[model samples]
Target: MLARMLVLRFPKEVVDKPIVTNLVRNYNLSFNILKAHIFPRKEGLMVMELRGNRKDYERGLKYLKDIGVKVESIGQGIRRDDEKCYQCGACTAVCPTGALHIERPEMEVVFESERCSACELCVKTCPARAMIVMFDKAVELEEELA
Candidate 1:
């Protein structure tokens, strides 16, 4: 099955609080939260993952909107770029999902696309700028490749 995911970027203050807990309790939804760091900036980004039907996803989005979380962007499925990767492992260190892993034996790194929530932390942490989170339209184009 295709796992559906969404990335919502909120102000640092909003995410640093108990809002996430409230979201879980109030919406009755399960989510994996990731802290992302986009380029040209030092602050982190917040990505939320939701599972289940389209209706459920939509409901969660409505809840987010009501609460005034400014969503930076949203996408479905995993996003990564192998060509841009330099295997530095900085992205792996900061990945909340453990989606990116570095194997010491070969000094090789792997990106588990299935586990990625498109938080863009990898994108930010990669000094080489290899990782990225493709937005809506881009998501469609990449689906076939994925």
Candidate 2:
């Protein structure tokens, strides 16, 4: 199955539509909703992981665009500043994706960009102001490790 993290913007006009349901029923795609804010008559945001056949995934994405949904990939938005972070583990507590975790032996906080959903929980909860959110996705985790 092809899996990807996506940020879907539901316009006010389509806020009440069954767009997600159609993705499952019509395109045979499976979705895991990571975070969502859906209010009636207002634009909504949804972060999710979608998995399915490559062909079906393409069709599903096309359908979303055709129906006026603004779709964007969840880029590498979660950033950590090593110089400022103190390994407090506060960010780990609120992270729903477990992208932030503590290493058992050394008691150090670790970040895995691949697992991040970019819900911005860590950014808000970090007391050290080390966890930041950015829009670039070009950087790889291995490069940071090096």
Candidate 3:
């Protein structure tokens, strides 16, 4: 099976359509929506993880593109600033994927970027503003990390 974190941008014209539903019904894909802001008659943005077989996943991507959904890989969109963090663990409380968690023995917060779904919960919950959301600069941030 192939599972990937994706950032989907739906244009206003197609925002009301059942685009994601078609991916499940026609392409045999399953999705876990981490975050979404959809406005009827306006644009929509969603962060989700789509899982399915390799061939089905490819077909689903094509289908989304054909229908005018802009798709992008969720590449290093969230980062934790160790210098600014005080190990408060507030981010861990709201992190749905457990990407941000406290280390048992050391009592320190650990950020696992790979496990993060780009949900932005940690960014909002971090009291120290250590969790940074870099959606617009995601590609550049990925390059910097590499």
Candidate 4:
């Protein structure tokens, strides 16, 4: 079996297609949609975890690309700007993956990038404009660096 986190960008033309259904029915794959922003007649975006047999995974990916769905790995993730942040813990409230949290004794905000889902909730909830997305790997910074 194979599993991967993929971001599928679909053009407006194929917005209404039963692409995901076809993957399950024809390719014998399972999906967990992590995030999506799709609307009819508009460019759509979907981030999901796909799991299936090795051969089926390969064939299904090829099919996705062949049908105008732009596929990319979810290597990029969330980051925090320590200089801009005040450790207000506002972002922690909106973080679904518990990537952002508050620490005791010092009232510090610690970011566990590994637990993040790249959902962008922290970005939207942050009033101080402290959190940002890193378009690479999501790794927690050392205390001295951050």
Candidate 5:
């Protein structure tokens, strides 16, 4: 499954009257949304996670752009890292969408990509920083630098 995380900034008038419900109703692709309170308080930040075929995803982006929302950043093809995770539940607690969960028996962490709202709280909260977020390309982190 291909997934993308995008941060959108909206104009004041549009932000005050968010068209979330309308977008959800219109889009055929599945999506999760998260709102962040940033400076210029009313401006608002919207994080969207889209899942489906490439064509559907592209169509969704165009629809959002048509609504006057500015795309701040776009990350693609992200997947969770189960092996590096310890089921600590820290990520789950921080996740606004409840996308991460600690499952028993295997004592591993599970991720529902479709449920991820792209808030990025889990990424910041993870002690191990094991949760991998991939864009169009993979990132190389040097442990020595840390």
Candidate 6:
């Protein structure tokens, strides 16, 4: 199985269409929408995790592009700077995915990257500024796709 986080931008002309539904029915892909903002007759933006077989995934992406959806990979990921973290547990409170949590018995903050959804809540809630967003990969991928 192949899974990727994607940011999709829809032009105003295609904003009202059932783009996601088509992906599921026609492309045989599954998606988990992390965020979306769409208004009728206006441009739309969505952040989602799309999962499928490698071939089907590629086909789905092509379909999106053919329909005027600008698809971008969320090549970026979150990293924790242990040097900057004070283990104060401030980030744990806002982490919706349990990516940042205090370990039992030790009372130390642990960061589980696999569970992270790149929501950035830990980055915002951390008083010590420990959580960092890495953007280099995203920039490279965007440039290559463009």
Q: TM-score winner among the candidates?
A: 6
lDDT agreement with native, every candidate = 0.62, 0.84, 0.84, 0.82, 0.64, 0.85
lDDT of 5 by residue, 6-25 (tens): 67767665775545655555
| Candidate achieving higher TM-score, 1 or 6 | 6
TM-score per candidate:
0.54, 0.76, 0.77, 0.67, 0.53, 0.81
For 1-146, candidate 4 gives per-residue lDDT tens digits of 88787888899999899999999998999997867778889988787878899999999999999999999886657788889998889998988778888888888889998877776779879999988877542232112112
Instruction: Write out the backbone clash pairs for model 1.
Output: 36-45
Clashes of each: 1, 0, 0, 0, 0, 0
Each candidate's root-mean-square deviation in Å? 8.1, 6.7, 5.1, 7.3, 6.7, 4.3
Relative to the true structure, candidate 3 reaches a TM of 0.77
Quantify how close model 2 is to the true structure by its C-alpha RMSD in Å: 6.7
Candidate 2 displacement at residue 102 in angstroms: 1.3
Over 10-38, each residue of candidate 6 has an lDDT whose tens digit, in order, gives 99999989999999999899998866778
Winner on lDDT (3 vs 4) = 3
Q: Give me the overall lDDT of model 3.
A: 0.84
TM-score of 5: 0.53
Write out the backbone clash pairs for model 4.
none
Q: Model 6: clashing residue pairs? A: none
Candidate 3 — which residues are off by over 4 angstroms? 134-146
Residue 115 of model 3: what lDDT?
A: 86
Candidate 5 lDDT trough over 10 residues, lowest sum: 137-146
Predict model 5's lDDT versus the native.
Answer: 0.64
The reply for model 2, stretches above 4 Å from the true place, is 136-146
